[model samples]
Target: MKVIAYGASTSSTSINKALATYAANLIPGADVTVLDINDYPVPMFSEDKEKEIGQAEAAKAFLDAIATADALVISFAEHNGHYPAAYKNLFDWSTRIDQKVFKDIPAVYLATSPGPGGAQSVLAAAKGSAPFFGGNVKATVSVASFYDNFDLEKGQPTNSAVADEIKAAVAKLNA
Candidate 1:
């Protein structure tokens, strides 16, 4: 499978990115592309901006990247329990190019936080909205208290139960 993965954040050291990469690699023999939102920066979306600048190549490229994917691994980073501006801006512009932004791609939706809720609000939002934008969300995973649950050295969850949960989801994604 050709998989496109990304953390919906602009941070260079995004924990969601780390989690996304790890999960993407779990798919057996899949070729994965981990895209950085920083690379696809677009000016904040506004009707005025759209009228002035027209569609950007960056937004089209972002849409094309996922359009060609056999599957997707997306991890949303919660900013005030919502999508960060950068990703949301890209979404807005890209949707103008193609209403089905995800191109009907099957996906494993994930979220994480240093706190106990694990960014669940954002994950829930993505799960609910993804389908409207052509995302076939297959499963969801959330890592709560990320620092305590994930082991960077091992590149997996520290808790066996969490690990098993993630593994099962990854397996389903691969299936």
Candidate 2:
């Protein structure tokens, strides 16, 4: 199976990215592509911007990635209990290019935060909005207290329970 994975954050040291990479690696036979939003940097989405220059190459590339994926694994980074500005910007621009960007693609939505809420609020928002964009929500997980529960240097989940949960989610996707 082909999977496209990404963390919806621009931070170079993002825990969300770590979690996404970890999860993507767990899927058996999954040819995974881990994306960095920085690679697709685009001006904030605005009708004025679109009218002025039309769609950017990065946006087109982003869409093409989604179109080719068999599944999507997104680990959202919550900023102020909502989607990060960078990810939201990408979503807006991609939607403008194609409203049904997800187009019924199976998706494993995830979120991570340093707090106990584990980005639950943003996950809820994504679950609520996913169907509108043609996403087939397959599974979800939230990693709380990311720094405490995961070892950044080791690049693995320090908490056994969290690791097992992530593994189980990956197994389900592979099945």
Candidate 3:
């Protein structure tokens, strides 16, 4: 299966990116493509911008990535308990290209934070909104205190429970 993974943040050191990449790697026989939202940066989505520039090449690339994926793994970084601006911009542009941005693909939605909440609010919002965009949410994970639960030096999950949960989620998608 082909899996597309991304973090909904532009931060260079995004914990969400780390978590998403780890989760994607867990899927057996899965060919994963990990995307950095920063690379697909487009002018903030405004009706005016759309009218003047039409679809940005970056947005087209993002949509193309989603279109080729069999499954998706997204780890959202919440900004004030909501979607980050970078991610929201990408979502807006992608939807303009394809109303159903997710294209009915199975997905594993995830979130992570240095604090205790672990981006649960954004994760919840994604779970609720995904189906409307043609996504099938197979599993979700919220990793709290990401620095404590993950080993940055090793680039792996240090929390066994969280690792098991991620493995189970991957299995569900693979099934």
User: Alpha-carbon error at 152 in model 3, in Å?
Assistant: 1.4
- For residues 1-175, write the lDDT of model 3, one tens digit per residue: 9999999999999889889999999888889999999889899999999999999889899988888999999999999999998889889998888878888888999999999998999999999988778878999999999999998777788999989988898778877
> Candidate 2 lDDT, tens digit per residue, 1-175?
8989999999999889989988888888889999999999889888999999898778888999888888888899999999999889988889888888787888888899999999999999999999888888788999999988999888899999999998887776755
lDDT of 1: 0.89
Where is the poorest 10-residue window by lDDT in model 2? 166-175
Candidate 3: 10-residue stretch with minimal lDDT? 166-175
| Candidate ranking (lDDT, best to worst) | 3, 1, 2
lDDT of each: 0.89, 0.89, 0.90
lDDT of 2: 0.89
**Which RMSD does model 1 reach against the true structure?**
1.1
lDDT of 1 by residue, 112-158 (tens): 98899999999999999887899888889999999899987777778
Top lDDT model? 3
The residue ranges of model 3 lying beyond 4 angstroms of the native Cα positions read none
**Clash pairs, model 1 backbone:** none
Indicate which candidate wins on TM-score.
3
**Candidate no. 2 TM-score:** 0.95
